[model samples]
Target: MSYAVPTTKKLIFDFIASRDTVSKGELLQVFDVTSSSLTRLLDEMTTEGILEASGFGSSTGGRKPILYRVNPIHRYIIGFEISRIGSSIFVYDLQLNQIAHVRWKMDATMTPDVLIHHAANQIESILQQHHIAPSQVIGVGIGAVGPLDQTDGVILNPLHFPADGWKDVAICEQLTAQTGIPSFLENGANTALIGEHWALRGEQIKHMLYVHAGVGLRSAMMSDGQIVRGAFDLEGSFGQMIIQTDGTRLQEGSNYGALEAYASIPALEKQVRTQVKLGRDTSLHPYAPEDIHFDIILSALADGDRLVTDLFHQTGAYLGIGLANLINVLHPERVIVGGPFMNADHSVYDTVIQVTRKNIYYAPDYQPTFSMGILKEDAVATGAAVMVRKAWDCE
Candidate 1:
């Protein structure tokens, strides 16, 4: 269709979106445009209500320059992210304030066709619930478990999914076709990292490594305010890293142990079940072994269940080995651990941290900042919305 090349206005809006506010002088210097040209562009953008002159900034020498910022309601985006726990869709205004959200879980299955159909329908229902017309939404974005064909928006065969008929589901094309709006897709780990980045405003810190622990465990890295997307969008396959060349596991098909098989919710659940079967349990007696979910084990740990707590210690030690490799190699300024793993309570998180400290190669003083994910359960959906903003912001 040969639309005009990206305009200077996009550059200006992007700059304003990143900063809380920006001045015309700052725009001129960074954008390499003359004063008059910058003035015309900003004026046009403000008139369109995509941007606004917020107030005057402190003057360096001349009159105080007017500060510009994006209009919070200029557009809206809907984001979808599905995990083993459930599928969720959230609506966000341009400023990324969540407008509405809907979620549903399947205790037995999370097959792709069913997930797509439900998630897309819920997105429509959310828009209607908020009295937002379909036309008001600029686009949609999805953050699903990856090993995706990003170019095609097809979720490839990822681990822990349905055993059969689960390959190359064109999520983006389906959602767009269903709703008549443009769509984008990204892997869950990248979206989680990006959501964390957006929450932090991504200006102060340049390097971050985020570990996602759930049915599958993986890590995402960001450097210089950019996601480290590999050639095929599979940069953060940290889970598949062979941690043991001898031990067998049920996930990701390994005769040797993989990271997820050792350090994820499913793995922990598996371990808990096995130990109980071997007659090695105490406080988890109220629930049958088959009924012991990750959450229940977390409760058991809170009640001072020695088996559960010690089990987490073991899991944490395994994660420490992986994090040791991650920290020594990546040297990220901050490390964030998130996902259903956090639901295990602070003791588990503390154990992971304590073990990580011992395993890192660096001296004690040089340790990177480590913490739990602040965005909680909504990180992936929030990050997917951020992607929609980034994808459609230029338009």
Candidate 2:
């Protein structure tokens, strides 16, 4: 059984959670309490299975100090990522180790009610299969494409959901009501960034940027270890930023020639289809242009289809311009790009790097490293679980 974690206990756990292992002496130095008092708290935490003595620390002219760490199995967290293309759920231990995961493709049948009930049922199944008591779970954290009322825990009118009932849905409330577990909601991009931040806690990256290219482009920023939120939760606003003043394509409800009009996965498909109509020669000519999907495009890309490669290069250049603008303003220490568009040896990623470098303000001293997201497809779901951990720390 775990003991009640008051503010002080939570603080200690937070510190220990942030590191691989921490010494009792270090805890005493950090927290303002008598050594005996702190010792009693640590003893209780260890006895309750919330913390474990990992090993001994280096001796400082005395006996080696004992190290303590949050026991990975002491508690669990559930993370959910709801997207227009797909949705996923992840179960993680206190240490953010993935215990179980499930995913499903988004379709017309996946309305709000169906999705929530399915998620709730799956949570129960996973808990039973893993021999985890429902009480062991900390809470559920949901990351979805938004325009969300995060304070009210509602999914606002996000565009392009496969189903019609996505608007103004109290998703968190519904999930919690069904499962009897607390749930929190945030933008998927923010959650992905949060997850990346947690995974790289050892790296201590304070300023970071995360961009995801999928049905649409979504972005989130982390400044000084905190996820930055705008007055309104328009995480997809970056996608609407005008990239070309007189360019042809315009995303629904977005500015003419928006970045998303050119860089999004749907846009890539559209571009490919347009080119096919214009009789651009490629291996994809065998497939009906209208039937061409992201998977088909990727298949053609893998087969070295010149038409597909050229289109990807053009798409990457447009996205790079948007990224360059962001980098100049934010000056983040690192940028992580993710989504279906990213693949091994894809020209899109390579071209994005080249164009970004070509456009960004030149400075020998300023170098912001760019790479693909480490969490990949699991980023949002994993990050949602990490957000639950963060909430626990606050509590």
TM-score for each prediction? 0.91, 0.94
Model 2 spans with C-alpha error above 4 angstroms: 1-6, 393-395
Question: Which ranges in model 1 have alpha carbons more than 4 Å from their true place?
Answer: 1-6, 59-62, 162-165, 285-288
**Residues 291-386, model 1: lDDT tens digits:** 988779878788888999888879877877777778888899888888667567787778778878887887576789888867867888898888
RMSD, one per candidate, in order:
2.8, 2.9
lDDT of 2 at 280: 91
Query: Residue by residue across 79-135, what tens digits does model 2's lDDT show?
Result: 999999899999999988899999999999999999999999999999999999988
Reference-based lDDT, each prediction: 0.78, 0.87
Instruction: Give every collision pair in model 1.
Output: none
| Model 1 backbone overlap count | 0
